[model samples]
Target: METELLSYAFSGLLVIVFFISIALAFRFSDGHVRLRKRLKSRLIYGLPVGSMITIVTVLAVYLFLQGGIHDWDNPVVHPFRSWSYFYPTGTVASGFAHGSPSHLTSNLTTTLILAPIAEYIWGHYPDGQGGTNASRDQPWYRYPIIRACVLFPGAAFVIAVLTGAFSLGSVIGFSGVVFAFGGFAVVYYPIITVVGLLVVGVVRTILDGLVEPISFAGVTSTLPGWTSTAVQGHGLGFLIGVLLGITLLYHRNKRPRIFELFVALLIYGLTRGLWQIYRPLGGNEFVLYRALGVSVVLIGAVLVTATVVASKRPLFEGSSVTQREAGVISLVAILAFLIGPGIVTNLVIIDYHDEPADDELAVEDYIIGYDENAENPTEFVFDAPGTDETIERTSSGVYVASDQRQLWIMDTSQNQLRSTGTADIQIGGIGWRETVTAERDGLQVLGAQSVYAVELRHDDQLVTAYESNASTANIRIDNRSISFAPDIDDRFTITVEGSDGVEETASIPSVNESVEIGGIMFRASETNGTKFISAERDGTVTTVAQEE
Candidate 1:
């Protein structure tokens, strides 16, 4: 009984839309095609209205099917009806569907405003001269309605049965219908709702996490994107909208059809690329995501190569941004490219060093990864020198490279002795035996010394004064090989060689510069910042300075 009523109502609605569109089309022009074009615009305007109507009408019918809108007049039989679960496929449309009069009237008001408008536009489609001026002559109505009637119920049913997901059956509404209306409009259609969602994201986050989460531009609540549940459908719908927009630019003529197809495909690919990066997926689909990512990378690479070879001036001019829109878009594009692993070259670096080949490691908050087949790297450790400074590095090998001039080597793995050499013959560090890194400049420690001294930086203005107590043996040099300062800052990491004549070797980062037994202190006679800031018994503080 309910199905019959719904079928009758739908048929009637379809008839009304068809007649109105055709009547309007004919009234506008004697030439049917010309009139159809005129009607197309109106359909564009009315599609949303029709879609809104479907929101109401479908809800009412759905209620009846669920037995909720039972023949209450004859209270003997009332049907069961209620809200449904979320289904990714059709929830947006289904959301509009409801269980009773309250639902129908609620949606119908909106439907009245949005659905009829679209249906009215369906009236305009080319038909033979002296055509019936009805659904018979309207391709717009036939194609859209036919597609919706077939696609919606059928897709929902098939998907539900196959997946054993009953939620699919519970789906309702006009979104899919409106989508169809929009699909026919421009294919690149722009929906205001999407932009609204993006704007609301910041506001929504603020309202949601009341306990103070993240803030942006003084706005205490903002989500980091990915958290939005409706993001997927909204995204897909947006893509369809844009595609419709592009389709509007398509020409049906056979002559330019091939070219138009190429342009359309290009637009689709580009848009899809944008979508993929914009909507990120997690590691579950590692293989698929990486494959797709690589494909995009290759495409972009080809474009870049072509651009380089073509030899044209950069549109930005490099001095300053010529246009604000262009500047922002360019910045966003650059950031996306960089983050997507596009800025890398074969002769390049993941950071200042090559990436590791194996699975990436999450050390603290830092994530380091290499190209798929790139070389693996050792974990990094910092190198501490003098009193307070430490240099961060990538390799475990203890080495320093301030300039390209020299490398300093501390046998970090060996506590017995620290070593250094001229980066000339053996370049010091890298040897196949224990594993080391060789650079241009390095310092050498004799036998087992307390500290392997090397010139960190020399700054002498012809006549400079350096004060020192026993604690600050501030070393000064006019021009020298190298020297080491007491590792006063971090006592734990200070590598000490032995106890006796200031000779000891320990672990990493700590420089072994000892004076007393088991202690590494300033060897320099002057109190310079290079080693330590010391005060004599008289309570006078002194410092040592270095020149670049």
Candidate 2:
């Protein structure tokens, strides 16, 4: 606790130092005159009301609605993810909800740094930008407070809902909106946006290092880092933001340099892993198309650059439509093409609502089970014609499925549990949350298969969910074979079978102990950190089982 407090203090001090350095640099720099002028004018008019509201609302949703106040680390996350179009709660909340405190903090931090910049570009007082205004006419809706408090926030909310509704699958985070803020700021202040991205990274690194000053870790199995990213939602948000930024810039009769916009978009896309275009081959397998992704991002950057920097003159000598108008139409068409697939995918209803399997545990709307390799229902939920044969999805390990939420995901894989021996699965909704712990206990025989059992514990109830087949060692001792099997009470039992129909079974003895069964004495012994079982009968000794 003392270490943690000191770490927090140090982290806070670093943040303060960073901001002070930035302030000093800006104060002395000649290039910051425009920024100073903007700030001076904006400060007297109003604050970044829309940005503050968004940050507060996102934090409130994560803390209160997702039950993060009590358990900040392990909040109710499954129910808040955008699962299906039919589930209104998930569809709406997923945009604001976060999977973990780290996720929430990172997104809020990005927003804190970039949102104000975007809002600054979109000034509190409209001056023929974003919307039309009559000359010297002050409309009631054109008030600074109205633009800052009402219009901006309202636009943000609508965008959030749209992002959540059109996201490819169950995604939970504020990152989509964060990307939107980045996209908006990049149009007017491309260099500043990139610098802000770097600052956000540095801040996250500092916080992480402070939280964990020293660490100990071992090798563990995990999927590719990009597999979990909600690329579709992020792309949609960024495109929308760019569109809005360009529209505002056009209305205000201003345009950024073409090269600057292209470079900024390209750099941001590459750094943010937007170039990771992947498809889940299921069973913890995924395939990423690096070349295709890079090409797509490059083309997208070129198109956006063209759209923003196009001349107002007509596209051709005979045509009335200007190049800028044609560019805007092309962008709108692209956005529609991007959104149409998601809408079709989301419209499909879940069909696998059968009763839970015998070995599966049922808790309210959730069904938990352990399986080596089972057909993943969520992958097939959207039965796109001819795609089933191409995308065969399978899952292995402890999984939780819910028909209502249209969720079927492997929480922990079989290999992970075998190495770690334990996992906790969090499941719940709205006002409540619960954790189901899965434990793997077993003994592996040398040169043979392992005998094991998978058990789950929730509240006071303990269930042995799965038991593997008994395995016997290949070696024999005095015409008797030794076999190991997992018993009901979460322990291994040893069985000795003789050639003349004589057999005996007994619980495996503890270390440095011996048990006699059917005239064969089985002794569990350890030497030089190696554990092995040996049998002695009629002055004959032979090795039987050993830890693998």
Candidate 3:
């Protein structure tokens, strides 16, 4: 796991421990009434239910992790199946395999956030006494803590399982419940339609952060690329949110009129048709989809209009709308809906059509190079005397480019290929290791995979090595230390304070981007205040120092 992720793991473990503590907590209060109330509020979000579900989920996951089964495709039946037949206490894998800290946080937070709200909703065990509702604005429902404790977490488990989310290690967030909330809200959307819609969008975006992209026929899912950030989960969440919104709408209406259901479908179809123009719709798929949309909308509109027009009479006039009139109004609304969604959709089509992928390269200038020999290519060097790219070096050492993408650390010493970016460096017996991290993990062997190795006689032999504060661009010799600059020729000043209390600062004017100090070499990108030249391959960067 990455170090950054590990940094956040402690908090995640705390959450897990917290849940276990809650489950074991005995409800021993002053009396039965007091005990009931106390336990109810404490585990307010159906903690018992959530804890039970999450414990099972966590245990199953622990088994997979312990068994070294990280990938989802390779099915590893967890202990639950085994407990029923094979073993009693099941199994426990030695090493911690719940992934990094970020992973833990994501999963834990999901439950903490969603459980309470879901439980609150499910707590409808009425006390058989109606609260004051003289001229009622809102109906009252009793909050039954126990019932909520049972259902909310149960619902969450069901959602998580159906989505194939909890089983897979990829998604680790509470967005599923958020989606369910949106779905639930859809049942009451018409009353506060705008607020309802916004809520749905917010929920969708939050959940989408952890799910697969919506892969409908015409929906290309350009949402991620558009953000220039990898948050496809939000897009998925948002889509689920849309379904939630619809659900809320349905619920508010209370037993959806069949005609209205068809109308809603019509609106969806028309919108989809408009989406197809910009997105990839296979051969007859486009025409077929558009035809369906158009047809559905037209039928829905006509039906709605007929219903609204036919239901013109309220027997007790002005008290409320008659069912027949409401139907006619719905029919008219459907006609309008069929036309409106497609119009807005068509506009989106115009915006997206003829456009390239969101991830298309937009850089104006760039420089790319590789090992010419392609055999034992370790380091790359550039030397220009006139270019006053004053790299801070007592004695001239090699400097390679950094930051502007590709990194080629040439072992100018003996042309030995130390390691690439993604290889894991394994350490067994005493030995020195030379390794560099590239794009992804190339060597994923068990334990620590070695990028390069040097002989160390004993197992615990200590090898003194310096971890650079910055990326290692080049090495420069000071009296005793080595320093580095940003690139081949960068003016980013690096100042070194020697052991003798003497400070020496060097400034490269142009073309000499990197240099070392004492024994430490700073990587180019992280070299303080360094920037690459406009002509990246122009061999040097200009150093315009404050003094000069």
Candidate 4:
């Protein structure tokens, strides 16, 4: 406890020093002149109230709605994902809901840094300037407080809803909105937005260190971070934000340099994983198009550059619309094309006839089961033209399916459950949540597959959902083979089968123990980091079962 306290104190001190150094640098830099002048003129009027309110709202959703306050690490995530267009609750809450505390913190941290910059571009006062407009003829939106509190927050909420609605699949997290903030900021301050991205990385690292000053980990397997990313959702949010920013710029008669805009868009796309265009081939498989993704990013940068910096002259000799206007129309068309397919896909009703497993446990509307290489219950089935390859995909894991929400997902993969030994699935709606724990117990045997059983526990109700067949070892003693099998009582038993058609069964002995069955003594022992069971008969010993 004392060591932890000291580590926290040291981390806090380091954070303070880092911020102080930043302050000192800003104080000495000549670039602070305009910022200082703006600050002095606006005083508290220019404060990022909208950004603060948005951040607070997101935090509140995570804390209360997602059950983060009760359990900081594990939140009710499955129910809050944007599962389908039919599920209104999920679609609405998905924008604010987070899968984990780290996810929420990383997103909010980026928002904390970039949102204020985007808000600054919007400004608190009307006329696109931070100045008091006391004229009665001024519109209500021109009021500083109204713009700071209402307009900015309202626009942000709209953006969030749009992102959720257009997202490709059942997606959760505030990253889409974070990317929107980046998109908006990059339009007005291209280079500064890049700098802000670096700052975000530093801040997130500091925060992680503060939370866990020391962490120990062993080599483990996990899917690549980019594999699961919703790149289409991110692209949609960024494009929408860029459109909004460009519209505002046009109205304000302002345009950033073409080269700067292109560079910023390209860099941001590459760094933020927007260039990771991929398609899920079900199970844990994905096909990534790296070359095509990079090409798309390059083309996007060029299009955005032309949209913002094109000349006011007509596109051709006698065209009425200007070149910039044409570019804007083309950009809007591209957004429509990107969103149309998602809308169509979401409208299709989910068919819930597919059963995940024969031995599924029903809790309310959820079906929990264990299966190996079963078809994904929630995956949308569609055939690609001119493709002979089977698009059918399979998953092997503990899965949870909900017909009402159109959710079919593997809550924990087989290998993951094997490594962790246990997993928890959180299910809930509006005001209530329940947890179902999946536990795997297994016995490894030498030269054979492991014998295992999967059990589910909800509250006090425990059930063995699935069990594997008994596995026999290759090594034999006195023409007798040893096999391991899982029993209904959640215990493993060792069976000795003799060539003479005699069999003896007994519970597997613990380490350093022995059990005599049919004149053959089975002893469990460990040596040189290997645990094995040995059979002794007539003063002769032979290895039977060993840990894989």
Candidate 5:
């Protein structure tokens, strides 16, 4: 519920900002852009105008490929569903393909607003009140083409690898590329760019945190909603842009004072360290590491600001930089930044003695047949295949069955079936019903049709510890604790197994009733038929619309 409120608040903030930007844009457009107007029209508008044109062209091609604009009959032709673009093809298709009209428009809007601003800065817009003449003949790397060449490939590659590695579903949009524009703007126009990107980042982070995720094949994919696509990709894209900006600072000057070099190194390290704390792949966050990461970034930002402000006696002070040298440095820096995380991830996985297939292998395979292939082998697995029957098994050889109107448990040891009443509704439509199953050695939990069941594995015997009906809108399992709220009720329940292995339930009043769970006190209420859940945790009160 808190998540929903944050979404509304962020949306409201964007609407307000949208109007403010319009007013500011017109106010600033009082015809004083000699430098901007002087640049080649293509250099000034290529990214903004070209990107929009490409989006529309791709949409037209997509319609032709699928026989209609709304034709989803052949999802293989859809960029987001196609495996071809998940890798090398990423360079060609990722930027042009968008999921919907709104998706395309959002990217177009941001690109139009931020890209032109960045292009002007790259064109060396004379700010009049400058210490050093940024108007000094710009290098080739500073040209729009070179910057796009570097930014597009770098951003696309990063997004592709990240989604391929961590995400089960595919994503295709220009959000990541739009973020790169914001990134370039930050170093070139710190005040405006930083503030703008920060607001966007915060809003996106809040939305990502609020959504419920579906666990499938040992991977958690967020259920499609208002703000789930490419959430982490935005973070990565923005990070890449910032890294490029920092590289440019060093490229401008080779010789520097000891203190200046120290500051530069500090900024670089802190930028990396900050990502370490909240990187795409989850990292263990020891308190000390997190604190130091944040502290370094803050200090680095201050030093960077100071250095930029004192441009005459800059930290990386050198006579001049050649175009080729700057380009090489930029390429190396971007590649290294993208590669470092992969190296660390591999090392960490190896150190922890973890294998990629451990989780899936642990889940018992109820295979009925197998298809052999030299390149990629396939195993045909069996389950109760029907709209109403879905079966899952545990590593300990117990099967839990969820069907319409009743829940069934079958013991492999005795080959017996136990049935219990369930609130499994006969709902129609794709989003109407959902199911998620998770398992451990002695535990298997199935959530479906607004009901959840827990099966305890005991010597090939399945023991039903708890079975109940609740809302499927929000169901979560952490170790032995299960948390959920019923769609029809005003309270949520937390069922935790005690030391004796017996299940106990605790019901906390919903947001309207003002109750506390896990130290978060909230009130559940209805306003004009819309249910809202407000939760207070760590002295912050967050209210959100309850999703049913």
Candidate 6:
């Protein structure tokens, strides 16, 4: 029922945008003397509306192949939906992909609102049908969007890669490029800031409750649902845009000061490269949040220094933006802003992460060499212990195998395996060396040292239930109950009954201590820089081992 409502809402929003764009396209296409042959002006009026049509069409195709409106995080679609432009498939496809409806709307509101004004400022060629006007106040390149379309992707790619490599996370969405457009418009006309702030503020207010949470301008919040602002991406794009503005818009006739330009470029490159290699921007607590602050400071400093040094000519002072033009553009953007959020809200309101289990293949279908001749088709059949003992398949293409007291979880769809509870451990806190249970409804893996659970409703997203950064020793799992000591301070027990799971934490008296409860003894100790734990059953030492 909820899915149907959401789908209808999304379709309705798209329909609205479709009609608006068509109307605007017709409006600009009309044969008024004021509109005819004014290629630059016509484009400024039409490009954003036309872009909306393109966006809607592509998103409709994405919705179809994804099987639903809320399949935002499909792995195959993710590569194309967001900008991971450093990779081969991400470069050309990033611009077309959006993760969620809110993501699309936020970026769309900014772009559609600001892009027309930017186009008019940079692209408007007044002398109709004539050749290029060298004497015009603007730069020689008439179409700013052409240059912007090229630069925005490159900027997004660079910033996303740098952030992923140096900072805490990678970025997606059109916000960064929208910031670029904003930066360009602001540089061209400072008065645009008033309108820019008002629009973003109003749009954010109306839509903040509908999408991921956002912090106000000065306050900092990293709570759940508070999406990352991607400071690095936005900063990079803004800086690049500012540089372009200085070069093209500010100094029309005089030669650019090469030294200042070099300095500005060098500072930007150096900061980004260093942030990637050795991110020192953040102090201890603010490390994850420092990228944007650093970028803002550096970009501002570079812009100031460049304006002082490289700007040989005065700022462009051609035709001032009239009140009538500003009002019209703002009105168009307001309509887009109002419509965009509804589309995003409908598309992302329902989480469709867990699909039905009707497509379950036979357990033997995934067993290797089960039907093959026992006679050697290949040289190695190397059967190991525990491999044949316990093997199970969950509905979500997850295979759980216990081999040599180690548990392995394999995703058949991606051909990836994560092994735990062995001598070799991938995560630091927990050690697993026993049979692991794979639940079907949500496909959670329960082991001695670690517990992996996926939220079926959240697109099968993997979430850690019990993980510690410190080494966890004295692991034990019995009758679907798990207990382990993490570092020197505390002990934790995880209990599972049927499909429900819960965890409880208890404090320890000292580094070396033992607890006895309900005919069971759990002890923790350390020797030779290694943690150890032992379980006692009915006054007998049942298990003793080193923490993995």
Which candidate number has the best TM-score? 4
Model 4: colliding residue pairs: none
Badly placed stretches (over 4 Å) of model 4 are 1-6, 19-36, 39-44, 128-136, 281-283, 348-358, 379-392, 510-513, 525-532, 546-548
**lDDT of the structure predicted as candidate 2:** 0.79
TM-score of each: 0.24, 0.87, 0.28, 0.90, 0.36, 0.40
**lDDT computed for candidate 3:** 0.31
Tens digits of per-residue lDDT, candidate 4, 443-538, equal 677778998888998977777888889999877877888888988863788888889978889987788999997668989898896668787899
Q: Write the per-residue lDDT of candidate 1 for residues 1-548, one digit (tens) a residue.
A: 76566656665665676679879978887797764555454443223333443454555444444333443221101111111112122223233333334334433443343233333423322221122234556554344444334433343233222221122122233333333333233122123222222333443443333322322465444444323222222223323332323333332211123333333333433432322333223211111243564455445333322321222234466834334234334434643433222111111111222222233222221222212112222111221121011111222322221111112222221221122321111111111111112221212122222333221111221111111111212331221112233323322222233323344433223222323213333232323422331212233332321211
**Whose lDDT is greatest here?**
4
Candidate lDDT scores, in order, read 0.29, 0.79, 0.31, 0.80, 0.39, 0.38
Number of residue pairs clashing in candidate 6, backbone atoms closer than 3 angstroms, sequence gap of 3 or more or interchain: 5
The backbone clash count of each candidate, in order, is 67, 0, 85, 0, 8, 5
Name the better of 4 and 6 by lDDT. Answer: 4
lDDT of 3 by residue, 1-548 (tens): 55445534644655566567655564433465564563454344213454456545554553343332343332222211111101111111101123333333444444343333333333333232222122335333223333334445455555543232211112233334444443333222322222433444444544443332232366442332212111222223323433443433333333444454444434432432222212223211211244543554465435533432243367366758875546535544533433332222111100111221231111111111122222211111222231111111111111122222122122221112222222222111011212222121111111222112121112333221111122222222333332323222232345555668665555432334444433333223313433332111124432212110
RMSD of 2: 3.9
lDDT of 6 by residue, 1-548 (tens): 76567756665665677679878878786565444345444343434333444345445534543222534433123333222212323333444345555666666666666655555444434222223333557554444444334433344445333222221222345554555555555555545543655566566664553343333476554432322344444554554455455455534443334454444343433332323222222211222334754564555545444453432232344636543334334434533442332222112111111222322211211111011011111111223332221122122233322221122233222112223321111111011111122221111212333322211111242222122332233334353243433322223332222113544444322338876543356576777855554556656664443433
Worst 10 residues of 4 by lDDT: 383-392
- 1 versus 3: better TM-score goes to: 3
Task: Tell me how far the alpha carbon of residue 468 in candidate 1 is from the true structure, in angstroms, after superposition.
Answer: 59
Ranking by TM-score: 4, 2, 6, 5, 3, 1
Mind giving the per-residue lDDT tens digits that candidate 5 earns over 1-548? 87567666766776677679878987888553654444444343323333334345545544543233443322212222212221234224444455554455556555555665555544422222222323348665544544444544444445534433322123466666666666556655555554454455454443443332221266554422322444334545655565555555555542234454444434434432332332221111112345754664565455444443343332244636544344434445644554443322211100111221211111121111111111111111221122111112211223222112112222221111112221111111111222122221111123333333333432343334333454322332232333453222323454444335566545545435765444445466777754555546567664522423
Residue pairs clashing, model 6: 81-97, 101-344, 353-459, 421-432, 421-433
Between prediction 4 and prediction 5, the one with superior lDDT is 4
